[model samples]
Target chain A: MKKTLAAIALASAMMAFGLPAQAAEPIDPIEPVEVKNPALVELGKMLFFEPRLSRSGFISCNSCHNLATGGVDNLVTSIGDRWAQGPINSPTVLNSFGQIAQFWDGRAKTLAEQAAGPIANPLEMASTHEMAVKVISSIPGYGEYFKKAFGDSKVDIQRITDAMAEFERTLVTPNARFDKWLKGDKDALTAQELKGYNLFKSSGCTICHNGAQVGGQSFQKMGLVRPYQTTNTAEGVKAVSGRDQDRMSFKTPMLRNVELTYPYFHDGAVWTLEEAVAIMGDVQLGRRYMKEELADISAFLKTLTGDQPKIEYPVLPPSGPETPKFNPWAPAAK
Target chain B: MKKTLAAIALASAMMAFGLPAQAAEPIDPIEPVEVKNPALVELGKMLFFEPRLSRSGFISCNSCHNLATGGVDNLVTSIGDRWAQGPINSPTVLNSFGQIAQFWDGRAKTLAEQAAGPIANPLEMASTHEMAVKVISSIPGYGEYFKKAFGDSKVDIQRITDAMAEFERTLVTPNARFDKWLKGDKDALTAQELKGYNLFKSSGCTICHNGAQVGGQSFQKMGLVRPYQTTNTAEGVKAVSGRDQDRMSFKTPMLRNVELTYPYFHDGAVWTLEEAVAIMGDVQLGRRYMKEELADISAFLKTLTGDQPKIEYPVLPPSGPETPKFNPWAPAAK
Candidate 1:
């Protein structure tokens, strides 16, 4: 009976240390996207880069969520309509659909829903759904695109967001070095990086940071073990739920392409990956990692960098005479 | 002697009426671009779309001179740094290389020279050449590009502008209906359009508006036959040449994609092509064109809309720790 107890104790200890768990892990590799409708995607690409959708006719979906720089504008926070500074860091749109819900507060349930919020936001694009539709519909060239994409020439807010969401779903980045390692490539990661991965798992970082996107699978409190200090006024999930307990709870930001999307965290208070990791360890895990351990973990995080989307900048159709002129300061079109 | 004099008068009348002059006309079709160095062009394209060159890190060259919409921002005058209004209209970059010089005032003799002006202009990009170079050099990914393009990894203002110029040279748009007609396609222009073309030549509009680019060949007075009224303070070539005679003298604007580039003239006062044509006739040619004549001439101008360049939006590299942060309010970097 003592031997049986000892055997159980050894098994539990091994699991805690992440020993012999390398073969089956919590993290999964990102899968390549399979596009079903090419025409819809093509139309969506045009709309994604169409700045005419903005009130100033200068901003677009790509303005904040730039595909060129790891699906982010790489700003600490975004600059919006007439250069109004955004409240929080613009999150990377890469593999964003893998998240259970959209936005840091999980307010948006789908990519399409998320796409609708920014277009009419006074601080962002500052254009209404009706105005956006009117501008697109008024253009003679977009008629053929609408017809080809939605089986009609009619332009609507629903079809617009649907197309954008479909295009965004195709923006998944697969086959990072970490993904290659997960897929059984023995030499994909360096010895130091592999050690860092094991440490990351054993230290319980993967509790909320797992799955294909690494961190977007769950919402977690910002400061679990210790209190966090920040000047940013955001109340996280409490802003949406109106619950005191949900005050500091936020959707875990995905780690994919985190290397390119810098000035880390919701407030974008942290600039370096090392500092971010150190803060995470102290406030979330109650761990004081050694210098080398922090470096190793940061190295592991860097391995999440993946291929970016190759998008041909679509030449948008010229505006027709009926298309409303861009009015940066005007109220939303009724 | 009487018969010989009558024959000369008939020849002069036929030339003035644009009869028997179809075979050898003033206009020439735009030639296709010949790209000699693909690497240089690729590097140039990346730089062209790079907003990091701006002090705000939000406005690239493509922001004002947008390739998606006839190479111009389509604004009356460009909205620049911190929403500063520009002095003059932004011209389309399409087929601009065919011009004798760059800018309305012809201040810059070459596209390479013109490329350097906006980067440090306080109201425009508001970034110094040194700062722009530093930002590009700090990015590790741009090193390979510089090396491939210039046979060295050294980033400088000259090489940067040169690469941009190389890319700009390839922005030529060919294969318009007018170009097809010039190349001997009989059905390229309809009956009304053909009649308009003849009237356009016979009315002496082709005196200044000629060549492959239609109008970029000469610096002509804005109101040659009458005093033009405008609230715009731009003195045109007088601002550059500082001569009283050069006042209101500007480069004859290109008409290649005139259909897409609306809000005509240096002040961008005229929104309709028909109104612009009527104004041009009254002010520049000293002739009052009838309503149907203006409509016909506008129809002829619409045929000049060529194929826009199909540019794949370049994926820019991530900024490094050493790269300078964007400061919209800051003075130029030393």
Candidate 2:
């Protein structure tokens, strides 16, 4: 009863101040992930770095969504199998479990589902599920890891994706200055950052960019007010939804660690943070910001840079004679 | 005086037993490297994983000499700049600092000198030293690291290579079963492994494969007795010396973690350790090994598998505007 009264009082006070009804409440602090099953995590980490999961035996999960550099390859678009160029910018895997769905189009509803897509993707890993399983099963050392991770030594695609997702769940980056500010540390952000936050709220940027993951709560049109020009031919959610209205709509990417994830936008057309901010304002909100305002907004965004996940590079098991040889020049398996 | 007397007594015993002059002393235990300057190592680690040193900004030193799986890519030959296939297998970087010289050709006398070759190789990183320097210099975070590592803020190729070489020097793989046996641990090797070691020494294999690194002391002809056959056009040491006798001669790769570093030999034609042992017996020793002998030699080689280097995946700094943009499609800059 006391908590309910306090909540009501806070809401009334927020209303009185003419602030957004959920002002200071939309953003939430991300907590560090705690692994329940260390064995599973250990196995998953090995799998994540295991290049045998790909047909080329060169690319791994870490190849594109690298944990070392903000969980991304830091490329405009990832270089894929046999140096094939990726069609879109690879999203950061950090804190992705908190998102409502996976991928820019939100095609896969879960992280595990997303994990399976790359292995078979013609331009990416260029591997069939059967071949991946065959390769893993052939390795004698992996059998022990599988037995430890799961109840048995079954090397199935489902188990593979599950373990990978479990490992990715631990990749949450916590303790950014913005997260500190959100957790009620008043001095965490600077005066300029505070002013920028106020401007960001007033300008209505948070309508789509809200909740725990900042922007992952909702899907929004790339150009709400104006057309966003790009050389990329990607049709956003329309490819998944097959709806004309969803043509330019995409899942609003999370703003956490936006500073480290460079070459912004789905097309990765923008390089600098300030430039991305300016373009977002002009295209999405149909507004122009002054240089000082841009600087403040950019400074505020920089505060989102969080403590990156500390990962011990796993020593992958050696391949046995049964393991299939990598065909670097081979086309994607049907 | 006591240690000298014991050594003399042991030498006399070996001579009495009709053992070779060096006998049990041929292979020495590898010692774990103790890092003195952590700051330099830290900086070098960042550079080692820094793809910005490549023209495409996708390949780092770890791409070919990966630390995760025995410090070698495990490919028959490395896939380099624009997916260009390498002419020879990449040697393991582990225990490489202990080598007489770097590369299969023993061209570069120091690890630092060898470090510069890949950055400029058109078929490899495809990056000029100037461009690499420019890119690294533009990143503000690297400046602080360089200052911390060298006691100055200068970002020269010399300091860069020096830092990288220092880091590579720490990549020694110690504490193998063979090392334990060498350190007087009687129970370290199994009966089969001990038998295999005896056969390995008696077959004259220790003539070239000896020392703490188990091979890296000198350059030897690939096929000492019989001619080796391979489609690979690499002329081995002849590429460096330009002498007829040095044509098929190459550096003896250190077999510290031979178990993990698979696809053995210069051309990486043989996949299995047993096969490699058989081929070596036929070509180098002028004798064909029986199946049991091959198995024994292979088992002995597996004892060389050491503790792999434990490394924390480093988080590289974000690229600045001043940093040159990566040209994934561009050819080697003239």
Candidate 3:
């Protein structure tokens, strides 16, 4: 007990300052989030999967961030309204509540604000917020759902986004093998995985990539020690803040469920985790990892998958005769 | 007892002939189908909702025929691959197994045949069978699901379609109020609905519209009495038989959940059930009903909405590194 306590103290001291040894990982690890609003969550789940909210009426939020396929579209970028290509890779919604802000550019601070942007974006859902609200109000079933969720059937865009955020909060993954190991389960990780964890800490990869999500908590330049070349057009943080110096700087993406969300980075150019790890080492730390080290790091990263959201598929209510129908190729209503 | 026996014998004799009486309706109410293969059914459920089978990797079978909103997309016509407008409105997948054949033109003889058409159709999923099979084979997790479903993980398009058909069989909607009424529960339908049913029988509507599905047993010329005029260009049965004389001839669509699967008819021009009923009267029978009669028929159609399939959303497995990444806007690979 005394030795373990000393080790923990030393690890804490190491994490506080810029000191490195084979120290304990500074990651807090994820815990199962409590669903604070059940009614709101239910409404949100429907809205999340509700394609009727879009102009196409066929492209729901679930179209891009599918729950079955790891809360992501699994595309390099999403296919959007009228088959328009999204500007950048869509970040996973699995642990998005933990994200400091929404979107790659951080244009929207709250989930509600972020939610509103997509509906009006001509390249995204391609429906004005007013039209979306008008369509929802026309559906009689949604009125009752709204009333049950928010005390009144008077529908608005704010309630829609709020309900979506409520459900998103419960989507935080928990009980990963590493989290189990962190909680003192000795057999939770294999020998190589433990070795990988130690190496990850000692090699300074944990400096920017730490905390509950192991990376989402901070912003860093895409290429710190070395420059990265890519065909992706995104200028990252500069698009939001309009700061020339902020170019190439992006929010460190969360590593949770990284195994499921493939084709890594903002461009989603990298296919394998080993390649991503090696690239980060060379570009972020100016260190080239040996082949074996890359393999070990990959083994450690696999343990972060955790539990996926397991709720039953909600049976959506049928539409009314008066409800505006989805006609994808139809000319937009003026 | 003798009097009752005489009435039944007389009714049977009349049914055998072309004589129409309020004697007995030929409509056989639908029964709940028993699910035979539970494991295969489970696998089929996943495939039915799997979007990866599409070229865009976003449009799944559910995108057009959504289970959440009555097995049909309720669009005037479906939206398909890369925003292509579908040739016709999607049929209700609910209780489609009861149909004699699949598709509006009855080109595919079975559901499996129908299932395969959309995957490769340039207007639909726009993916070749070979590429789809390759993608599924690359995913290691699907191997287990396939093994459990077919006793082999050898992923093939045949297995994919078979699994989807198996799941679709379980989508049968039973326990409608009309079914109860047919089973001698006098109180199952309201007085107005009963009046509407009687009117429907008194008219020749019951001639083509009989049996378990209320209409899927035979094909008839669409504009029998009066030439139905519309802007839509579907030659119906002629497209298959290549017979010009078979123009506008179509299989009578099942009336089950007709309330949910609107806009009605091959053109999907009519929106309301009342409007459809009125059109059928004028075009098919050359008889326009009174306002009260239209209201009663509308009430009767509402009872066709049976207990919908209550199911949970399935969680699909992650992709392997070898799986082809979806990037529609990306420059074509050499």
Candidate of highest TM-score: 2
Which parts of model 3 are misplaced by more than 4 Å? A1-24, A332-334, B1-25, B330-334
B1-334: candidate 3 lDDT, tens digit per residue:
2332454466558757955442265777777778787878888888888888888787788887888878887778888877888888788888888788888888888788889989998788888899889988988888988998888899888898888888888887788898887776767988778777767766667787788788877778888899999887989989999999989988889988888788889888888888899989888999888787788778988888888887677777877878887766645335
- Prediction 2 TM-score vs. true: 0.93
* lDDT per residue as tens, model 2, A1-334: 2332454466458768876533456677788788998888888888888888887889999998888778887788989888989999999999999898999999999998999999999789988899889999999988888888897899999989889999999998889998887765778989788666666656677787777777887888999899999999889899998999999898999988888888789988888888988989899999887787788778888888889989999998898989887757655445
Worst 10 residues of 2 chain A by lDDT: A1-10
* Native-to-model Cα distance after best TM-score fit, residue B6 in candidate 3, in Å: 21
Candidate order (DockQ): 2, 3, 1
lDDT tens readout by residue for model 2, B1-334: 2332354466568768977543467898888778899999999899888888998988999998999889998888888888888878989999898889999998999999999989989888888899989999999889889988889889989888988999999998888988887776768888778667777777778888899899988888888899888888888888998898899998888877999888888898889989998888888989788788788778889999998889999999998889877758765445
Clashing pairs in 3: A313-B313
* Per-residue lDDT over B1-334 for candidate 1, one digit per residue giving the tens place of the 0 to 100 score: 2332353455468668866533577888888788999999999999988989988887889888989889998788887787677888899888988798999999999888999988988778888899999999988889999999999999999999999989999998899999898776869999778767777777788898898899999999999999888999999899898899999999999999998887789998888889999999999989888898898889999999998998988889888878876644455457
Per-prediction share of native contacts kept: 0.58, 0.69, 0.77
lDDT of each: 0.85, 0.85, 0.81
Q: Which stretches of candidate 2 lie over 4 Å from their true place?
A: A1-23, A330-334, B1-23, B331-334
DockQ for each model: 0.52, 0.69, 0.59
lDDT, residue B307, model 1: 88
Interface CA root-mean-square deviation for model 2: 1.0
The backbone clash count of each candidate, in order, is: 0, 0, 1
Clashes counted in candidate 3 amount to 1
